[model samples]
Target: MARRRKGRAISGVLLLNKPTGISSNKALQKVRAMLFASKGGHTGNLDPMATGLLPLCFGEATKFSSYLLDADKAYIACARLGQVSDTGDADGEIIHERSVPELSIEQLQQVMQGFVGAIEQVPPMYSALKQNGQPLYKLAREGKTVERKARPVTIYSIELINWQAPDLTFSVRCSKGTYVRTLAEDIGEQLGCGAHLISLHRTHTGGFEAAEMISMDQLQQVRDDEGSIDHYLLPADILVSHFAKKNLSAAETARILHGQDIANTENLTGMVRLYDPEQQFLGLAEASETGRLMPRRLIVTDETVTD
Candidate 1:
């Protein structure tokens, strides 16, 4: 017999304002225990020193979590110029320090302009990227350095928010898999001074914004007041809101639930959000070039079937 999981089968996405000094997985676990949810997962990870928007998925909502993983992200980062760290962030050991060169805002802006576009970034060793079934950070802890290939990452924008001699603050909007720490070091290199990331806070990811995020204290207060946490949860479909929506009749919905394709006369040739006639979210479907809507992921529940 299969063993059943404990806790309620809750579903939705929680935009958590993760505090600094805690890993993303730890934050997700705390929220899961508070909600007593049967399943939970984070769309992406934030380092222990990084804070801000972390979208958490529970139960059925987890099915769409991967969409956010590949989504673009925005962050405000503070980098300390003239200093270098082994881990590329403030938490790492200080490796070197140099004299800060005199630079103007115009000069800084000119330097930043070079980063706005597609570029290659070498993954840092002190990262969660795995190597031969083991995390690279683990190897780093053992004083081992491995060769990491440079990967392509796009920076949509990079703006200097503040500059205070050795400390520089900037905001960046970049594609997934970008390493902001590397960016700081690269900028420092351009100015002939070493640098390392001193702080980082993610402001946005996919369709979720930092404005919608709630803190751990706020969540606990709601729990103490016996208020439903669902009040803060956004609909799971919001993860794929960028995709076009398709409404189907009861017959079509039934056919889609059974893993069958329906004719897509509109000839939409990409992923789409599916809903029933009553507007209840079904799941996701892929529209083919041949004018067919093929079921990809479907939400299964007792209430899913309807006349």
Candidate 2:
């Protein structure tokens, strides 16, 4: 017999304001425990030294977590100019240093403009990227340096926020998989002074901003008050809010949930948001060019019928 997991089969997304000094998974665990949720997942990872917005998915919301993971992210980073760290961030040991030249804000902005577009970046060794099924950070901890290919990533925008001697702060909106530490290092290299990120904070990801984020302390207060934290959770379908919404008849809903593909002739030719007659979110379906609405991830068995 299969053993079932314990806890509430709740479904929704939590916009957590992740704290520094804890891994993303650890933060998720804390939130999951508070909610007593049986299943939970984080959209993407944030380094222990980083903080700010981290979207967490519980139950059925996990099905659409990938969409947020693949979405663009924005961050504000503090860089220590004239110093280079082996890990490209403050958490690593300093390996090199150089003199920093005094510069005007205009000059700095001009240099930053050059980076506000598509650019190739080499992932830092102290990263989670895998090689031979082993995380690169593991190899780094053992003092090993391996060749890494420079990957193309778009920096939609980059602007200087503050400049105080060797410690400079900047904000950037970039495509997924971008390493802000590498960006700081690259910018330093351009100015003839090496640099490494001192701190980083994600302010925006997917279509969410930091404004809606809840802190662990606030959650604990609510829990102490014996309140339902479920109220803090966003609907599961919020993950796929960009998809075209389609309301299905009771018969169509039943057929779709039963692993059947219905006709998709509503001018939607991609992933579509599905809703039952009562307007409860069903799940997502892929609409093909051949006019078939194929069930992809359904909520019928996902334990929560999010409204």
Per model, state how many residue pairs clash.
Answer: 0, 0
Q: Candidate 1: give its CA RMSD in angstroms.
A: 2.0
Clashes of 1: 0
Clashing pairs in 1: none
Residue 102 alpha-carbon offset, candidate 1, angstroms: 1.5
Give the range of the ten consecutive residues with the poorest summed lDDT in model 2. 298-307
Off by over 4 Å in 1: 303-307
- lDDT (tens digit, per residue) of candidate 1 on 68-171: 99999999999999999999999999999899999999999999889999999999999999999999999999999999999999999999999998999999
Alpha carbon deviation, residue 12, candidate 1 (Å): 0.3
Which candidate leads in lDDT? 1
